[model samples]
Target: MSFQLFGLPVARGVAIGRALLVSSSRVDVAHYYIEPAQIEAEIQRLRMARDAVVEELETLQRELPGDAPAELSALLDVHVMLLQDELLGAATKQWIAERHYNAEWALSAQLEVLARQFDEMEDEYLRERKADLEQVVERLLLVLSEGGGGRGRAGGLPQLSAATGDNPLILVANDISPADMLGFRRSVFTGFVTDVGGPTSHTAIVARSLNIPAVVGAREASRLIRQDDWIVIDGDAGLVIVDPSPIVLEEYRFRQRSGELERERLGRLRHTPAVTLDGEPVELLANIELQSDAEAAIAAGAQGVGLFRTEFLFMNRNGELPGEEEQFEAYRGAVMAMQGLPVTIRTVDVGADKPLDRLSIHELRQEQGLNPALGLRAIRWSLSEPSMFRQQLRAILRASAHGPVRLLIPMLAHESEIRLTLEMIDRAKQQLREAGLAYGEVQVGAMIEVPAAALMVEAFLDRFDFLAIGTNDLVQYTLAIDRADEAVAHLYDPWHPAVLHLLHHIIRAARKRGKSVCVCGEIAGDIDFTEVLLAMGLRSFSMHPSQIPALKQKVLRTDTRRCSVLRPARGVPD
Candidate 1:
């Protein structure tokens, strides 16, 4: 009989394939204590392993497919940075010197220490990066286990299965590094399941970029499925079926064909304007992390770029943030790619989850016991580092000359923050004038992810040109539940009564003030809530580019006049 295992549904579509199992890396470790006299040799061994992983990551970066999503390359670069981080390997050397533990034992022990710190982080994105850390450590362990010579492939898993028939190979593993995931990009696997990972993990992100059907955090996916077993993967439902019955397989296969046809039909809507049946126009925009991703947004027929997460550009550069010219070129690339479409560039939002490359996670926690989400992040972090903050402002203002650009400030909760932020923008403009640089005017926007900001929308509208609702943080702060935490993730509801009321208030206030407001969160991408959002008076939505067509279809079928009809049933209030 076929059995089922469920996990987090990361991407869409159904895949029927034969299993290809990759073993877990956290195994077969020798934990004997080493003599003090042997400490130097053991430490050198760790150094060689770290260096080897760096070489491996660089090789993978050089070998990334020409068509690979640019974000994938950034992830690979992060892995190399992890290898160089003293927190990861340098601290382990301390264990060897003090406890006299073997290199493997010391490394794994250090991982446990750092993982606890990561677990305490408030940002879902940063918390999910623990998977990346584990994957990096796993690579180091692999090299040490194999006597300091790591292989091109991971865990001896083949790059491509021997069989490439109608039944594709499904990768089932404990975890996968983005680097290793890139290596398998051009392989026979059509879908995958991992024993670990959340929606925001780099692994899941890469899977989505590859357009592959995937499920992550299936605790037993690797242990239960045998090699070559017939399996069915339901990416939408986050389900994996092993040795599926013929009847069941046929059902999924039919559904798969139907999904393909539906996609083809939706593809026809790309050129159609997003106007509701009642003649109300809605703006559909794309949220991007990289300039190269702008092409994807254009391909999906986005009206503009809504959220350009600039932090990815600052990541994994071995402690050095990009300078103004480098940052300007990146912002310019996205602006130029949009070809007259406005691009909203949010300043780098780094906090506990997205610590600067040089920031020590352990030291910060020890020093402040800070909650990564509530601590220095977004506008707060930018304001704290005024020079770095000014560097970013100058770049965005410079990019505006290329085309329309919006300078969005994240996490503004006070009048003082608004004043300071505006002063900084004026300062950046002044600096540009002094330097004789060409720049253009930008529509400055405030991100309403902070409850305080949402509650005082009138104040924001008084000072800012527009408002962008970041529902991800709004929902997190409203419910006090971290979506990345497995224990509380189930309680992380975006449709909570409080969240709905908050959304209603923000949209209503923005409209009353005659200010443009757009929801640039995960909720904007979900088609199920389309009518409800419109019912709540929303006219603009920003989401992943892949989500544009379906959402456009939803808008086309909806009647703005009847949006209130979604009210009582969904518990929306006046």
Candidate 2:
């Protein structure tokens, strides 16, 4: 069988061999209905589905071929772990139990909730993670209904299939989840093309991690692509050509060869230092959310952990608040895993798009005002809830005893906020001291996420130990653009003169006071802007651990003095 599918470009250079075309026919189930109370039974039913998958994963692991591909084994490990991950399982169970929804319905409803929240997120990168979550849920549901006995094996049972020779199989899906990507047996899969997902999607991340050529945003690839069809996936150009002609195949083959050569050249850069043309050194650090990400950073040659988001700890089972000790353990592990490298943990900046289960949605809406970007959030929220602040502060302080730790107060618009945060830190330190607990002397810093904070950098230069520019929020707030609204996503440009001006001023202020300035935003990871940022006197950049290698490559090629020639539209320095 032969067919073609195409959409916006995503991955490039796809390997091809035997392909598996999964066909799904949508069912409009209006007649097969259950009672309202039956929803309760359905809740139990969904848990059974989860249990079934978990058991299937275990059974398959024990049954797979002794020579199963390493990629497939890695994928299996992720699936097994995902079946047990507290976040996904708990969220799924909650939706089913509380709403009496079917497994699919529960997954869909949870996606809707996360999508809505992410839709309100001010950070484009963080906001994009919602898509990853959606893809994961979608994959899980597919395996639940269609996969035989848990594995998506052809026999509806645990089985291992290998692609003949080195021909890569094309992966087609409506949405490929992280677990699905992890479950992929590398020998059977050469490239990936999906109907839903973006560059920031989990599928894309996995593809990139494995150096597999992939293409995404192929709206009809899942519906059109059949097993064993010749397909070309161009990642750099973001194109997918289905059932490519002989000439097209030849061209792409040449491109693939060229790409491999280029990649080898870039690979050698891993050993190079991120120095400029003038030989000035720049520190490239990785941003992380979990301990699992640390290894990736180290492998990528990142100097240290730059931004450690701490909100994951606060998000509890079924959206409830996690205990203080639970938060401490999470922070402690991340700090110690860094092996004494400085890890700056940004305090929970939940608000607007990200709601805390402890607070009512309505109350949050009110406190956030008409504009969330301009509303009560980050340090403001922590200031209002002293107890919450104290708990986190204490955990961070205690973790400092294990490794180098720094506390970053987000959305610091006024000096008073910094003072209050400092006061809270003191209280936490005092309490720990009185209780005879050992804690390290942690550095206190502030996030320049607000416009007021950006312009008033000089006022705050001496007030904090360090400054991290949160370009995502700072740009959104500065331009009065709601980044989460796809309708206006185009307007949320990080290169806007206004944003550049703010960054210039903030960096200048920090340099004047001899305080370290780092940017923990998406822009920091942009390979194209590495030179521009270096010229602007940026000493450090914090981004996803996955981005470390490429950014480091950029840094090593840049000349700090050459980058300095670039000037901001506003705030002309004397």
Candidate 3:
């Protein structure tokens, strides 16, 4: 039987492939048969998974702070012992070899066997150890799932399957972090479905940048989809079709080809400048994370790099923050890669939804029953940790010498925060000079994310060299919607009359001040907003590289002269 699941259609394309499932927890894993010839390979996977878990446990133990609870340390040690026990690895390997089960299934089967034996044990303490054993197995299961098909440089999981055939793989996961989704650029996966994520999520934003078909917020996608199941992704319709009949498959294949042709057609606009039909030039920029993302930006013919999120450097590092030199090199690489194009490096925005690996989700929002969105994040987190903030600032300042670099601060709403931030930048420059380090000047800008900042746009334009409108957070804050929260994601409207009014106010304010302004949010990349924003006097857009072509196409068709009748921001709702 054929069934379909609905989600937010983020990227527009069609993908027909086999489902490859990844899980955040061990509760659901892909179970498939292994070929007789591949039994040894499966055992090797089990060994690698075990070793990875062991390494992770050892790292945790070594990094445990001296102030950590005695019981917590002891519990970690117990889990390490369970993971290192020879019997666990030996028995799990046996399951793979004898039963031809895949790595995750084999290891889980062994855990079940041990669990049953413990349930029948006479000693209560030994029986209770079953929970510890289960924890160890769960950890190993997560490693095996992330290990994917093969490993690449920097220990990246390159592909989802070793199978080299006609049908490509489609990743189905409970949820994927933005850092993990960056790996998709090199992976063989044709498309992906996440059980939880809103349309404007950072992960979804990264998915769009990857230029792959994606369906997010599919409530039961991970639970319902099984390994190696034939799947059809109608990204335009936000539909995931499973077990499609031959007739339906044929129809989808045709649609897939049509989408491909359309993409190919858009590729022709890569080198063309974005100009309205009336000859108003529009600048399109790219929002990149890693240094390697520069190639995609240049290939996409972006005028420059805007909104270089520096926070991604601090994620998934096991609590170890990148030092000033490391940060400088990373920043420099991006500037150099742009080859004279300007790169705007936003200061690290960690906390809230993008907490450091050391801080759990609960820890981020436990105090005052506070919502992370409203908690200390972005500039607040940076301001709270002045030393770290200075380190990042010094690095960005040094990178300025290599190429044109712009400093962007996120989520600022107070005069005191702005004053402190400016003083810190001066202090960082002084420290770098005292250290005899080469540095250069950079234009400092502020991200207008909060409604408070947008309301006081004149104050921001007065102090800042430029302004970048982060429409994602602007709408969320304006509507009191947590953009990342799926429960109210639909309420997070970028087209709210108030949101449009704010955008109009900010853009109008910037123009009046003769200061440059750019929209570096998800809505900036949306082709639907190209003409509307152009009418609002927005001449610059920063977004995922994949979004540029279609937007440029829209820009080429828009007539700014004719938009005078549609100029009023309040006229949007009417």
Which tens-of-lDDT digit does each residue in 160-225 have in candidate 2?
Answer: 234122345566666653433434533356677777654544455456645677766667775555
After superposition, the stretches of candidate 2 with alpha carbons farther than 4 Å from their true spots are 1-235, 238-267, 352-376, 568-574
Cα lDDT of model 3 by residue, 376-399, tens digit: 789998998898999999999999
For each candidate in turn, the TM-score is: 0.72, 0.63, 0.81
User: What alpha-carbon RMSD in Å does predicted model 1 have with respect to the real structure?
Assistant: 14.3
Best by TM-score, which number? 3
lDDT of 1 by residue, 1-574 (tens): 6899999887788988877565334454444455667889999999988888899999999999999999999999889888889898778999788766567767766776677688789999999888899899888887887874222333233454333234477888787754356445557788999888766555676676566899988988876776557889999999999988888989999999998899789888999999999999999999887888899899899999999989878765667889998999999999999999999999988764456665566257737865667777789989988999999999999999999999999999999999999999999999999999989989999999988888888899999999999987898788876544445656778778889999999999999888899998877988888999999999999987888999999999999788788777787787
- Better model by TM-score, 2 or 3? 3
lDDT of each: 0.82, 0.66, 0.83
User: How many clashes in each structure?
Assistant: 0, 19, 0
